[model samples]
Target: MASSIHDLARHLNISIGTVSRALNGRADVNADTRQRVLE
Candidate 1:
């Protein structure tokens, strides 16, 4: 399991900001990307 946002972002091949945005449900994040982050 991912222990932190950094780990999750690395695993997902995305930036930390993207992960943060997705988790926070920011409008700028794409729907598919958000779903992947959520999962």
Candidate 2:
């Protein structure tokens, strides 16, 4: 099952907006950050 942005942020110890942007494929999110989320 996929986790929500809030769950991801808490799990990854990052900000919610950061997780949200990564998940939505926002340009603000770096490749490494996005890759971390995917993994």
RMSD of each: 1.3, 1.4
**Candidate 2 pairs with clashing backbones:** none
Which sections of candidate 2 miss by over 4 Å?
A: none
Q: Which candidate is the best by TM-score?
A: 1
Score each candidate by Cα lDDT: 0.94, 0.87
Model 1 residue runs over 4 Å out of place are none
How many clashing residue pairs appear in each of the predictions shown? 0, 0
What TM-score would candidate 1 get against the native? 0.90
Per-model TM values vs. the true structure: 0.90, 0.75
What are the per-residue Cα lDDT tens digits for candidate 2 across 1-39?
968788888988889988888888899998998998878
TM-score of 2: 0.75
lDDT of 1 by residue, 1-39 (tens): 636999989999999999999999899999999999999
